[model samples]
Target chain A: MTATTPREATAPAKSTRGFLRDNALSLFFGLLFLLALGGQAAAGWADLNNRLHTDGFPPMPFGRYMTSADFAVDVAENWQSEYLQFFLYIVATIYLIQRGSSESKDPGKEGRESDEEQLIGAYAKPGSPAWARIGGWRTALYSRSLGLVMGILFLLSWLAQSIAGRAAFNADQLRQREDPVSWLSYVSSADFWNRSLQNWQSELLAVASMAILAIYLRERGSPESKPVGAPHDATGSES
Target chain B: MSNRLLAVPLCALALCAVTLSGCGAARGPQDAAVVAATHFAAAVSQHDGAAACGLLGEAPRTELEKSAGKPCAQAITGEDLPGLGRIAKVETWGEQAQVRGSSDTVFLSHLTGHWLVMAAGCTPRPGDPYDCIVTGG
Candidate 1:
């Protein structure tokens, strides 16, 4: 073998070949989503057909049902809540401090620190990302960019859910020979609120469970938790 | 040859490939409106009272009595309504349609098709099958 060269040692490595090697959970969940979605579609369509037959209405085609507001709202509401969970978690992590929980920054390291602590301003090395070295509005923007993007995405998804939910609800009204609701009215209605709250409750529960469980739990190589050998008292930085 | 000269043909070829790969059939507003209407109609026909009520506008379901007139009734086990079988026809124009039943023609419009009710009294009244909010025969 050739002598160990400094250049070879210092050079940054390239990304891994496949998602399975890089992000196994992402790939797994993606497949799971498709499978779950297919099951939901089948079950929803069947349920819908049964009701139609009882009410003197025509059963819809399977493909056609896929485009229904019911399907869209159901999917969108769940997606919105999930994204909202992530968004809230991201933003909360920035300022909040937890004493012993793995999900939070250490109490000692609470609040925004100095430029050197953040590796921005004068402490930035030669090869730092451009935003880190800029040290002005750019740096300020970059610092909060993650939360900002997450918040915006959460809002957009929530809006999408509302729009789709309203449409689905309105379809029901028409069936009973009732007038349709406006988008604004739908947003405030019990129908929209019910869907939103149900999804929000589940998402909050999952996030809370993760935060609390991470305090003592160990998941081998998972970054979401501390290393198995790490002390239960350890906070923030994972081993 | 310069890269620019080659890029033009490459871009055109890429566009053609994308279209061939089924990325071009974007659903228009009209199509979306029809789908919305159909979804509404289907929801109500299924006897999903709650879902049908959700599809109505404030003007239509504002009064409790009015809402009660076309209420949805939950079907009994195994018993099916003849009209609720297979979808015989779906013709959409913007956000309205004249759904022809074996016996009667029902007027369907976006948000006005699905009106789920605890009773059969809450179903909304479509002014007339032929004279809907948007005109369609």
Candidate 2:
């Protein structure tokens, strides 16, 4: 008879939970993202067409508009700002402390914690991530991987926004019988800065609101909020 | 494992942005825009007022008639439009393009898959929009 270890016995039951059930959170958000994108495409296409008609141009087809810089710039601008917010939040939370906000670390625990506290090197469990167990540069890099990825994504999205924005701006210039500026000029233009700052202001406000509101509000079972019975002074404690 | 997953989307996004930006100033659209501008210039030079006016966008044609108190074909020929030499340069962005000739510049918009002149006989004005002989509202 084969002997089953505790980990081996539990592995089969965990696997049987099904992929969709295990990934429900990510799957739900992914679906919402696709739906919202589709809705944006439809609405943007109609809006562009309406303006084109008023300007004595024919309405653009749905497929053409989807590939156009107008749609690309709009999508990229919003994406870049959202990623920037998350990137900033992830990095700032490392050293910043908010006394009672669930979004921040406890005041006494601010800054990058020790290797033992983070389960790196000799302190890592056998099942910890490979980089965490390996130590040295790899461990250092792995520790910052989340914030690094978010920062990179923000930069990529911003670059996409600039490229697409120049194209869209040039198109409008042509429509208005004005000269189209270079990429560098467009990036430095008031229009570009306006678009970026508008989205950024909203995102910063949202992050600030969440951090402050979570201090006093209780969302019962939400991981983003302290437990319903927990004191308002509690920090970094989730249900 | 999660990092590898993130890497996939990151790489994909980078590739997509590169591809999308690379689409600017495509050869086909530039050539088409130049052809449309050349056709309009040729019509003007040949004194075929009707043909030249036919190339104008609906709004521009209407604007020309309203401003001149006459039909577009008649008023368009009377304008002091300079002779356009060979096509010097073309820049296309999305459904809009500007074709610059040796002597003049013309703006066109791609409508219904065809390039139509939106403004013609345009001259650069310092710190302002190009002053054009014919323009759409």
Candidate 3:
């Protein structure tokens, strides 16, 4: 019988099974996202048809409803808010501290710590990313890449929400025999702010709830929560 | 593999956005709306009540008949519909449109791929729906 070395045992197996296992979390969530989106489309189409019938309009085809401004706006509004939530949480965590939350850093460990602490430039190990090892502008940009990407996605989806929202709003306006407002006018209108603020409030609330809840809660096997045996005062400790 | 998976959805979202934005800006829908508005206005001006009634949406047609206690042909001409002049502006937003003529405005809905007038002789009300002389119930 061959004895397995610690390094060999610790290293992931080079196989399809290993790949699937490694990516299981992301893959699982991706599948849920597609299924949920499909469900939303189907439900939204039916609801829209009901409204159309009530208003004496003909039922819209499924394909047409999928491509409509109403659907686009609905999807974009939620997407923008989600990205905004992640962007805010990521950037805020660097400066903000929670005394007893697993989601936060130890109170004294706040702010962008030293380059050594981050393993950048001279402090970077051999296995560190190329940008971290190389340092300079690449390192600086790479350091903020996660937050930057989230913020960019938020902005893009928010812009999309505005465009699609205006189109949907104008369609409703025409239904009521009202004039369609200009893009600038639409952006400044209550309809735009309402859609944005509603989603924003919910996302903010959920994030706030998670941050505070993690301080008192324990989920044994979850990385998001502290180990069950971990003290209630423990901060940033995951299972 | 993970990168490719991410790229696929991102590409799909981009494509969806492009398709949606394209739909909003298309000239075909605008032209169709304009044509419907023009036909309705022309029929009204010519005192061809039947032709004008035919262009109206089902609800507006039924409402006109119910309120007037007469057939759509006789009832539409009796309403205070203005003689709309040349088509001045057209705005279409997914299955609905608003067309403004030199003298009046017309609202239309695209039903089963055909533009039908929902309301005519509409005047803007401050912070309220347009006060339409003819509207769907």
Which has the greatest lDDT? 2
Candidates sorted on lDDT, descending: 2, 3, 1
Write one digit per residue (lDDT tens) for candidate 3, span B1-137. 24344445544554565455535458888899888888888888788998998899999999889999999989888888886687788888888988888888889988866899999988778888888888886
Look at candidate 1 and tell me the lDDT of residue A180: 54
TM per prediction: 0.61, 0.90, 0.90
TM-score of chain B of 1: 0.34
Q: Write the per-residue lDDT of candidate 1 for residues B13-129, one digit (tens) a residue.
A: 334323321133234433454444445456655766465446444333334323344332322111132232333443332233334344323444443344222222122245421
Cα miss at A181, model 3 (Å)?
Answer: 1.5
**In candidate 3, what are the lDDT values of residues A43-138, reduced to their tens digit?**
999998998888888888999988888888888889889889999999999999777788998878889999998999999998999999897899
Candidate 2 DockQ score? 0.48
- DockQ for candidate 1: 0.05
What is the Å distance of residue A47 in model 3 from its true position?
1.9
The residue-by-residue lDDT of candidate 1 on A115-172, one tens digit each, is 8888997889899889988889999998887667666656655766776666556556
Off by more than 4 A, model 1: A1-20, A23-25, B1-106, B109-137
- Give me the runs in candidate 3 sitting further than 4 Å from their true place: A1-14, A237-239, B1-23
Pitting candidate 2 against candidate 3, the one with the higher DockQ is 2
Which prediction has the highest DockQ against the true structure?
2
